[model samples]
Target chain A: MVKTQIRFGILGCAKVGRKMCRALELAPNTTLYAIGSRSIETASRFSSENFLPSSVKLYGSYEAVLDDPEVDAVYMPLPASLHLKWAVLAAEKKKHVLLEKPGASNVSELEKILDACESNGVQFMDATMFMHHPRTLKMEEFLDGERFGRLQYVFSSFSYKASPEFLESDIRMKPDLTAQGAVGDLGWYCIRAILWANNYQLPKTVVANRNPSLNKSGVILSCGSSFYWEDGRVANFYCSYLTDITMDITALGSNGSIRLHDFVVPFQENEAQYFQACNSKFINLSTGCEPARSGELVRADLPQEALMVQEFANLVANKADGLKVGKKWADICRKTQVIVDAVYNSIVRGFEPVEIMS
Target chain B: MVKTQIRFGILGCAKVGRKMCRALELAPNTTLYAIGSRSIETASRFSSENFLPSSVKLYGSYEAVLDDPEVDAVYMPLPASLHLKWAVLAAEKKKHVLLEKPGASNVSELEKILDACESNGVQFMDATMFMHHPRTLKMEEFLDGERFGRLQYVFSSFSYKASPEFLESDIRMKPDLTAQGAVGDLGWYCIRAILWANNYQLPKTVVANRNPSLNKSGVILSCGSSFYWEDGRVANFYCSYLTDITMDITALGSNGSIRLHDFVVPFQENEAQYFQACNSKFINLSTGCEPARSGELVRADLPQEALMVQEFANLVANKADGLKVGKKWADICRKTQVIVDAVYNSIVRGFEPVEIMS
Candidate 1:
């Protein structure tokens, strides 16, 4: 018999995990089964603060949560450095893995986790919630349709100003914990958006900008890159921990263009919108364009994170019903990781062009 | 005696010159004094088609317009390669020069034109009309105020898909006429927007993207570049003649961000708008941002082009009153040309970093 609801065990008390806990509650096919922290007191505190059901289990260690027979999946929101070990262990324990973004320090480490998931016959997905938003689907339709011809250029930016305390104590500022720094934390989304715009085709080359803002520990706080394809297609992205909040993507095609100011997180929870212009041309006398860009609004039945949880759980349920593991999410995660690795490598090589191996 | 109205002469019957002809008529302190082309028949045809006043003069050669004592300023919409010859001649004849962009083939040629203007006591300005739009002034206020902290990053894109006939015949595709091609035609606006956001401070280095689409004549059809400054400020821009019409600029600062889609040409001629978010932060639970971007609309008393003509006329009128030639427009044009040269140089050197000399 197939399980109707997937039981999710969250393995960290990170601030992002609080949002995921709420997502788990909202997803129809997912339940918050367990909360785990290094100390039982922390787990209990998180459970009480989030108002988890009394039936929810509390554990002092991630290993205990992974060992629980009733937990069908694990949501790991740990630091980037810990992803490979815990994500691999969760997959080895036959639990579906919904790991947080910046999936691993590098693609090599991420591959190890993917290998374990394949051997364990479990689902593996990175929690890029924005990908699950209905607005993304609407934009994809425009990109793939005839109105928007071949994609030629894409530009994305993701940034937020960090407070003084965040700069001093956030895990992202530490070289050992989030080694990729702003590139891993904020750039992951920008890179993913670029890859998505290009139908997951990796760029021919990547070159990071030279003037990266680095902390005293040499961690990148801000950086950008230009991506090039063999077909003369180009993409660029800027990510920073030192600028005001901005999430934008502008994708242009031979005949159309699409722009969205809030690609990562919509301003509102229930609805999101994007602007598109097809065959826009200047009017007579070049006073203005003939057809102004039109905004398309998409309504979401559930929050983006909740929809992500539902999607992950549906895959896990199908796997439990004797179906083969779906590879789509894994493939998408790998592509995003490869670009992230290439960007980091380019930065390391003094802003030299780094060809994508794939 | 100081002239109360600046009489404008236009060189070349190029398509853009038609727009400026209309602008001269609309500007309060300017008049369409003369229309010049390679042939008198062509100039007469343009004058009749554009419905010029019966009092306007027609000239068979650009030099004829410069020699006309009644013409106080000349708007030269000649090809990029011809600017060096015609702009210098116009200035030598004591005609204030409002040259269409890209001002010249390179800074070396532009400097010669500027030198002639300064020695002749005549004003020099590029016809980048958007710079004079009231909306730009409003956006500048936001960028210069305390609401937006130090500018850290700027990204701009300007592209338009050209028809097959255009690719085959347009001067922008001919290296002899517009050697810079898309870089000069479209990228000029993007580079100008970047420099405008940064207060005309030239970036320290510019590196072109590796994949630049080139025409058969070796003219750039599409290209992009990443700019780096010593203070960790960065800017990137993409320009193309092979994509849909898109004009965008997103400038991010430490405390605020501003975005506008129609930066080059407003959607409507009468009014323009931009979006800004100051001190925006994610609300509790990270569900959504607390302050959404607010759109600021600016109404134009005259079209941007007309305002540009009026501003140029005012400068010339002041010069006629024995005031020194204003150096601000000249300085702006020189800085923009410097970056344009650097971007082309970087592309020529196989996507290598090219440093700005001044």
Candidate 2:
């Protein structure tokens, strides 16, 4: 029997925020208690349709939801640039916070949000949806061991230019607001993959750089990042928003290399291809192979969001500390900022290999 | 209509020289006249029995065949370490010379051989049978005219491992002898590809680097070369013996990218693939697809060996100069030497990008 359910009040009744509302509706020991948006009509529609009786509350503004003593936490799906401000504000209201990906503009912004949670005794974490996907743990398993052999190199490239419909001069386009586009949108995904393989340890002296020309914004929309792990395994990542959307990662090891296609969105069949190097001969580990099926998740499965929500519940219910989760979020945010900043700086200064300031 | 056929004398009867015998056996106006090996029995057995020449001459000493006035030209496939030594001797004897892949051990040595050929007034050219292929002109057609779009990048890689039969003590294992194993073997092939595409124009600057720990000798066995063509196209190449054999070149233009599969052997059955950027999407240009048939030499049918041999015949038969041929040979040889040398230097100096000294 479930007791002591944690309720979430979603801020910003945007598309992602609405999706989170549906996820909360299905989650065990959770309920969508309230809705908040700048527009009262949007919040009212969500609250009335999803919640029953006094369980439903509508707010004309985000601050109204945070101020409500009845709400335990608030989910922040505002623009990436506004994440830090809202997260800190929610923490100040003693409400646990689930901030979306690119968690805060950079490392320092993430730290400030985390600090607010600490002082106010509230939980704070990034709602990186990929993290909630269980198969991601399978990828973690693949890279965790020496089964693939001593890692030599890593290659990842994620790309997709925003459709004209999506490129509506949003917060993402603001250079100072979003720290550029591709780095936050696609590049962060690659960095997370690297960190996952590196045991959450940052690379030693990364040769990360980027050159995003052609994108109108002064920010780099194309970037190449290189990571040199302590173990001498080098990882290189290529990301571009001026291209199509696809995720691929290749890990070259001493004995064989592993190529995980659709890594960002692995086969619903969960296919993984292994390439074995037989003393200079590359033998395909999977030839004419069918992709293994990925685990099926409900539309509201919302694993990454669910995990962030669950972690907050554990912190409050079990009195568990969220130091590790907050720190990892900070680390990812920090490296991404350093890399993207270096790339733009390098390109501006003639595309030299700019050493990451981090 | 038939005239006196050009007679070929082979020294060392090595693998390449043996392959030369087989290719000459297929040649239209060519005859294997004589064979010379360190051992007379070896030469005689190969010349009389294996090759089955109408009249065969065998010589135990290299100079004996070089002095053969009947032998119009010599295909010298000696060990890489011995190429310069025998090439000079053959040139001094007034025999038209066909040196294998790397005409000289080093850039300085190549210059010295060039000097010898000029002073002796004897025809000399490197036996890069690939250039003889008829398909090269087709590729030239694309790169020459503003064919598709501005050429921005070129990526080429060629790799293959040693057969299990390779002995550790073989000359391929000797550092000083086969100083540039992968670089000279595979790297030279790619360099030729770029030069051929650029119509013999030198790149403004060549930035080269390679893996340090992978090679046994200090010389580069795996190399990466970046070239800035005089017209502003950037070409990059990768070479390795430690990877699978991939003789593919991807030329990315503003509007599209052309993929040449088996570039060293371009006349394959199918067109590899072409990617064109359209409407903010890359569409694979499989618009024109057809089956292959024998006796059909499309753009890919560049009778590489035939051209080199014919050029040699033209230069020798007319009592004319091979200066143009020599110049091209010298360019490839010198550039290969420059890149191989620079890449090794880069690795030794901590994987730094080394500038080409050519």
Please name the candidate that would achieve the greatest lDDT relative to the true structure.
Answer: 1
List model 2 lDDT by residue over B1-358, tens digit each: 2234778888886655655665566566667788888889888776655646657688998989998998888988776778878888888887877888665666678777767776877677777766665555555555555533455555565544445354245566567887766566677778777766555556656555323234445545455555655444555566654433445554444433344435564323222222223123422111111110012234422234555666666666655432343355555556656655554455557655545443
Candidate 1 lDDT over residue span A211-278, tens digit each: 99999999999998889888888999999988889999999999899999999999889999899999
- What is the Cα-based lDDT of residue A153 in candidate 1? 97
TM-score of chain A of each: 0.99, 0.78
Give the Å error, residue B68, model 2: 4.2
Candidate 2 TM-score for chain A: 0.78
> What value of lDDT does candidate 2 attain over all alpha carbons?
0.58
Can you give the DockQ of every candidate in the order shown?
0.84, 0.09
Output the number of the DockQ-best candidate: 1
For residue A169, what is the lDDT in candidate 1?
Answer: 92
Indicate the TM-score of model 2: 0.66
